[model samples]
Structures are given as C-alpha cells and as structure tokens.
Target: MNRFVRWLSASALALLATIVLLPQPAAAAPIPCGHDCLGISRDAICWEKEWCAVPIEIKGTLPKEGYALPYRTADGTASAPADYTEVREGVLWLKPGGSLQLEVFVEGDSVRERGETFLIEYLDREGRVVATATVVIRDGV
Candidate 1:
C-alpha cells in the first residue's frame, strides 16, 4: 500500500497538489486566520485562495495513522470520497459569477496531536462569486 501511495502521490495530479497539516487549537492557534504553525515539512502550509483551475489540496496528518478525505460542492452537493495516506488532492473549476467550496477533516489517536481540517474556496478567472466545497472528518486510528 505504501508503494501504491507513493506512486499515486507522484504520478497523478497529486504531484501538482499541496497538502498541509492542520492541528486544532487544543495544540496551537486556529488556522485560516494566519496561524504560525509548522508541518512535518515546509509544504504543509496554504495561505488560502479561491475559484480557478488551480488545485485545492487539504492534508491531514494522523499521528497514529487512519484518516479520511471527502470532496463536495460549496452547497454540499456533488461529492466524492477520497481519503488516503501520503496525500489527497482536489481540483476546482468555476466560471464567471461562480465559486467552489470544500472541507477537510482529520482525526487520529495521539496525545496533543490528532489531526487538522480546513475549509477551502476558489475563485474564477474573472474573480466572480461562486460555490464552495464540503469536507467531513471522523475518528479512528
């Protein structure tokens, strides 16, 4: 499985993806508001952006293991289950006067370090309003 994950992480758009670790305030400051947090690596941070062909990636680092990744529409419509290790990636595309939304959830079994989630949104080329993405998190390590 590790091999497969490595392959997927490199061969697919995931290579063009950007996953970041999100730890809850119980451990540090709240994200989405410019929190000074660090990932196991430097690629674990996303300042936030909206609407475009750009890939929207949310990463969850479970201390012990288990995790999930679901991608849904801004209004919670059109969804696809894609929870995995290594990394997860979601592509967003919107037209003028449209938007996209998503929520990323992460849960693990480790003291002071379980997981993190993020609400990601993207804007169209013309910078118009659109939809959002839906993300769901669960517990299980």
Candidate 2:
C-alpha cells in the first residue's frame, strides 16, 4: 500500500509539472475597435468648388456573406441645393475588409459664411439609421 501511494504521488507530480512547463499556444492579437465597426475616414472636410469624395473605412470583422445597406445624407446646418447636392438614397455593398467613397457635391460662391455640418447616415434594410458620421464643411473662401 505504501509503495502504491508513493507511485501515485510521483505520477501526479509529473503530470502537474508537464502541464505547467509545457508551452501554450499564443493568444490571438486583439482586434482594434471590436468587431462590426465601420466609420468614415475624416470627421471633417473642406468644401471644394465642384465636389468632395469622402472615404469610408470599414474596420473589424465583416460578415462573410456580404450585404447591401442603404446610405443617404441628411441636412444639418447645411441645406441641400445651396450647400450640397442631397443624396436621397444610395445602396452600399460591403464585403470583408473592403472600403468605399461617397461623393458630395458642394455649391461654391464668393459669399463668406461660417462652417456648416451635415450627416452621412447608414441605414438597415428596414430604413432605420444604424450608423452616422458628421462631416463639417469648412468654408473654402
């Protein structure tokens, strides 16, 4: 019985040592901002005479199946037809690790005024706004 007990203790110690000393698989690097994060590259842009194309950056893990979402612009301090050309509704097709740009037409004039803002909104299939990016239009002149 004493011999058996000693053998059992030794086996247990060997197993513990193996578990403690053995290398483990390295942990995966954490993704920045978490999964399903999408955003615009710039928070603001200077209004050009003709138009400005804003780049939308897609980050984090994207859906493998891909999807199409609705996007549109909403007036803030800036009004359409005078400040910008309104995008009533547009379709945005997205894939894993992909990016796209949005073009906004700006009406230019010699008149001096304060800065204006507008919203670029991303919506779901039901037309509910999901994500939004505010763009500040700086006066070019």
Candidate 3:
C-alpha cells in the first residue's frame, strides 16, 4: 500500500511538471502593411523654377498610432537653399491610412547646366528607410 501511494504521488508530480513546462503559443500581432503598404505617385519629378509636389499615399490596415514621417535630401547636384529653397526635413501628424505631399523648389538661374537630381526619403522612428522619391531639377535657361 505504501509503495503504491509513493508511486502515485511521483506520477502526479511528474504530470504537473510536464504541464507547467509546456510552452505556450505567443499572441501574434497583425502586420499593418504586409508587403507594399506605402506608395508614391511619382518616383521621379521634373521641376523648373516652380516648386514641385510629390504625393505620398499609405495603403493597408491603418495603424492605431500616428507617425511622424522623416525625410531628407541627399546625394544630388542640387544644393539646398542654393539650387532651391530648403525643403522641410520632417512632416508631422501623419496618421495611418492617410496621404501627404512633399514640395521641391527650383531656384531660377540663367546659367545653362545639366539637370540636378536629388532623393527624398521617408524614414521610420528607428531611422530605417521606408520609401524614397527622386527629383530632377531641369535648369530653366
């Protein structure tokens, strides 16, 4: 009787341990944009004298939170405030399932020169690149 009781108690403990050690499945979070969640109307733009506007649209499930879209001009013959007016580095209050616009200015000049090209990028909070748009400034001589 004593041996049977001990065996029963050990079996119960082993069963309890097995149950406690079992791994639980984690709750999965939904992906806001599965693959292509962000989009831009024009990847490249041509501007002369007048400012150019590029439209950006977000497509997919709207996130519950709003994001501040970060952007910067880089690696282009055009210089900020020289070739054109300084573009706003970042935009604010960009909510999910919404759209925004980026404006590029071209400073008027008389000298004939090759068109200048520049890139405008959108970055996440972690500074990761989300999207990019190229602007071509054709000299209006």
What local distance difference test score does each model get? 0.29, 0.70, 0.65
Which pairs clash (backbone N, Cα, C closer than 3 Å) in model 2? Answer: none
Report the lDDT tens digits of candidate 1 across residue range 1-141: 999998887877554454334443343211111122211101122211211122333233222322222222232221222221211334332222232222233323333322233333333334332333323323233
Candidate 3 to truth, TM: 0.58
- Using TM-score, rank the candidates from best to worst: 2, 3, 1
Instruction: Give every collision pair in model 3.
Output: none
Better of 1 and 2 by TM-score: 2
Candidates 2 and 3: which is better by lDDT?
A: 2
Write down the RMSD of candidate 3 (Cα, Å): 18.1
* Minimal lDDT window, size 10, model 2: 26-35
Predicted candidate 2 versus true structure: per-residue lDDT over 91-135, tens digit per residue: 766666665566778777777889888887777667877666667
How many backbone clashes are present in model 3? 0
Q: Which model scores highest in TM-score?
A: 2
Give model 2's TM-score versus the native structure: 0.61
List the lowest-lDDT window of 10 residues for candidate 3.
27-36
Model 3, 1-141: lDDT tens digits are 999999999999999999999998443222223233444434556657897776666555444676555676665788777776665566634466555566766677778888888777666667666666767888778
- In model 2, the runs with Cα more than 4 Å from the true position are 1-42, 61-66, 95-98
